[model samples]
Target: MLQSDRAEAAEAAAVIETQCPFCSVQCKMTVTEGGKGIPGQRRAEYKVEGVPNAASEGRVCVKGMHAHQHAVHSQRLTHPFIRSNGELVPCSWDEAFAVARQHLQGISEQHGPDANAVYGGGSLTNETAYLLGKFARVALGTRYIDYNGRFCMSAAASAGSKTFGIDRGLTFRLADIPLARCIVLAGTNIAECQPTLLPYFNQAKENGAKIIVIDPRKTATAAMADMHLPIRPGTDTILADAMLKIIMDEGFIDETFIQARTNGYDELSVYLNSLDLSQAADICGLELEQIREAALAYGEADTGMVLTARGVEQQTDGHLAVRHFLNLVLATGKIGREGCGYGAITGQGNGQGGREHGQKADQLPGYRSIESEKDRAYVASVWGVEAATLPGKGVSAYEMMELIHQGVIKSLFVMGSNPIVSNPNAGLVEEGLNKLDFLMVADMFMSETARMADLVLPVTSYMENEGTLTNLEGRVLLREAGRQAPGEARHDWMILCSMADMLGKGHYFRFHEPEEIFNELRLASKGGIADYYGISYDRLRREKGVYWPCPSPEEAGVGLLFQQSFAHPDGKALFSIMEGDPWKGVSEEYPLILTNGRVLSHYLTGVQTRRSPSLLARELENFVEIHPITAQRYRIRDGEWVEAQSEHGCFTVRARIKDQIREDTLFVPMHWGGVQNVNHATRPDLDPFCKMPGFKTSAVRIRPLHQKVYRENDSYTER
Candidate 1:
């Protein structure tokens, strides 16, 4: 039998504590339990106690305080369930395993393996991610497997690897930000998203450092900045070219460093000289004076750093924007330093781990390209498979959705992702999922997408499982199970392994323990950017969290990467010749430009956060923020309902008057589902290079709802 509720009280009263596993700050937290519940009931409630930590300083946000609520919510699925007569019903573990295996095998035999795809999320642990990747590549023989990281960090990773030969996984140490004289926060709302990093920004401010913000809207972070340039969307590359032109004309570049550490600078200089500030100002929709101030401020700072996030990376020009940012840093001699560098703030907690474990279509463990014979042979030998039989790169998320709708792909296994609510052109994505011959969804909750699944396998939540998470800071921390599974639900790793064994791939999935899987992953990661062969659970416990590249047993973990030299072949970061066109979708018929992002009260798609009363109380419906002038032009009043229509679909929401927004633009948080799904209106046109859709901007129209003298269908009586 499981331990009694008294155990929670005793454990909380103990001296030891753990950290919140959500974000990178890794705030230390002490656990406590509420007094006994109704006398006859055996349930106990857990509470969070503060611990002295760098980020929280013995404090936590509302999300951290209510994390336990997420674990034990009534909506949680506590039993193995299978679809029967178009409705999911609880079933035995053996029955669930048999149904999943039989369907997957039947689909693979009838249609090629390429007809099926798997999607993973960054929330899974390294051990779980390792097993998932192996199951897709080694067992199913399908290359059509990708993770949610492709939508978040792949562009940044691609640019970094192309320039530095290694990706920077939150390697910028907190101890160094205070030394920098200037900090450029571009396209990131760090103040609200990662509250833990605010201290470093505050420390930099105290040290007399200049702060510059580049974004389309004047966000909270921008409001406090010394200078904020509201550059037009999709025009970052043009601005980069203008900056390079000014740098070359004013002789501000580090010639010695360029000559000694870089290549292609001369060619880039010529390409940039072809473009000037006047033309760039027109293309970027920024005044000449504002552009000059931002460029000169950055060029003149004693030490400079550039920090970016999803706002910059989720667009169609994401890769070019990243490469351009690298160019600016390298030209200014900021690549290798204490407080000055280029960093991409990751979104998901384990985004770094997800990409590292071979969940990407074209990559293997250690980030070796699957198309390269040498890399393939190395990984094949490690996994005990023949290199020749390994499939090549596969379709991305957008492509997969389109193919599924076109009847080219017949089956899919979705793990921990809700693309129906999160993907662009979500209406089409939903249609594609509905049309699939077979659909399997494995998650803790019956999410919007899971409700349409042909099979739903109940999986354990974070609190009920023991695993590891790699945060935005590149620190890897261990997770201890805080609660037992409520019913028959199992960990995702165990479920995947069980299915693999039932499908006759038992040898490759023979691990009885998660640590054994981790050991194999460490072996596969040898001699790569992240070396973990010498790392063990005991060693991780000895330290708070270990950064990668601790390849040797005697070596301590790395805090700052590329301190002396870059990983690039030339020992310097490479810069792309940035060039781009202007925003092309807006028109007289569709005068307003629509932008999408997060609100502090809610998370992505609100699949879990919305269910919490505390979070839901803050916001239960969607609202669009429009400039006061624009709202007046549309004759819309605050708290009044409005129709927001795009080319693909339309959603109705309340209109809010805010002077912070640009006059000709609209700001809508993309967390709502059912009646107010924002992704329904987002276009699917992708960045040519990275394949990321242009979700940031689109043509939109807003109009006030027609008022009626009397309500048509009144459910409430007037008092």
Candidate 2:
């Protein structure tokens, strides 16, 4: 078993408080030790209770309540595995490490460092992410490094940095939600994706705040909104442009604030003037009055906020879409004040902090650009390495996979991600994995991606590991270890450190504890945008949580950013000029638009959540949500099996005929992989600026299945 401070016999049964490891909400919870347990043999059973926190306020989602179950689940990986004769078999840790080192070194020596790459996950702690990036650049000497955050919130980060010079996922705290006069939540279903946040919206509603939801379907969150503008899929930019045009036409533009705190207003005005609301309305399939009403409600409010999610940030023009959405906030002067600002709703645990560290392909610690010589020099000094030794910026998540398929990236190291099920095109990703000369994966479970690795290492889950996670509001909370890890399972950081030692880079990675790495991270991030120089593990435990930009101990963490000035050189935000058709037209063969999203019961890829019997009972299988008109045209009945096909691939799922969606669009949940994987049909078209795959929109056709069938290769359920 993994080592930990043994609890006293009397204290072993006491309750321990920790943060949920699921979504970015990071709700606090108290886990009570229940069943009888051995001293160092096995972990005790846990009963979870919601604990009060700044974000959740004593509320927890179903997923969070049952999170402890997965830590000691029967399916948890407890030992290392090495491929032998086309099958993975149990192996000693030393043998596994030796094999991995041999293959990695051979590949690097033959093909150079560029041929090896590392793909990380957004769920990792700030310290793990920092070290992983350092390991990839300094130890591996490879420039190819990126994380799953590329698919989560890279668009928002790119747009926020370009506009305001910094990105923190949110500008204010979650407690401020109820104080706004109006909130425009575009393309996000917070009610389901983040159930604990619904109470904040409810409080806002009780305070007479008008809520406007912009989405193609009437989601659970939309049902509670004052108005739901069910625009056509991928028309977010057009609708946003129309709203801006109306706001300008009605003289709602805050000229004084614009002149004082922003630049490029003339460029924005010219673009707004060129947009025709009537034409945009036609293109978006919404009445012109609906657009005007949304614009009026948002602009007329004394204090309003705007938020976007994967629905808008996963498109080809995701960055442009975010920039145009911010125009509404800038025009109305609704930012940098109490309960007023624009931000992206981060989806993954530590999504905000993960990107701030050096995990992205083009970023260093503290959100510094890797291409900047000054930034590189600063980071190099912290690592005690020559600045010129660090490799430059590399390709993104999808691009790295493509390189693997082409034999350009000969070896890959994956941590905390299941790309086979989570990536845009599963077939393509699997082919790339098969083409790799060496593949190493470290995860708590034997995930689909892990199954393909030449060597798989077992790692501890959140409940059994101690680290820190940054919530969506940019609040960093300590995730205390409440239980012991199962046999032979180590923390991801410990495993990385051991691997670094085996690879002849032991001098650089001398971390014996998470806090040691965290201290180094604080120093590396001292002067950058996400400065955490003064933050410490002791401080986090004492304060429960602290926001970023905490430069000193005397000053309280910054809960609200840009109260007086922006992060730009001139202390002003920029208005980006947007130009493009937001919509990708439907073809004659594929006559409908396919939109995919997450469900309440399951998290991304359903790797851990699906293991919980409670969650699995709620959402047992995947299904396509089709409008009544589309179902009638295809002769598909409610709960009938149907095959959805796109130009890339096809998958079969049951159709749930409902009127909540638009007639021309079909909705599918993206949590399922294996035979029911919707990503099989998802196109690999990526946003040029951010490299985010277009998982939201695809052109596809559906037909009723004549016979009851299940794909023979469906392996997700077997676990």
lDDT digits (tens) for residues 151-262 of candidate 1: 7786788788877788755547666778788888877887766666777787888998888888878898888788887877767778767776776677778888788777
Q: Pick the candidate with the highest lDDT.
A: 2
Shift in Å, residue 501, candidate 1 = 0.7
TM-score of model 2 (CA atoms)? 0.96
In model 1, which regions exceed 4 Å deviation? 1-18, 37-45, 50-59, 707-719
Model 2, 116-182: lDDT tens per residue?
Answer: 8999999999989999999999889999999998999999999999999999899888988999989
Model 2 ranges off by over 4 Å: 1-14, 37-45, 707-719
User: lDDT score of model 1?
Assistant: 0.77
- Compute the lDDT for candidate 2: 0.89
lDDT of 1 at 361: 80
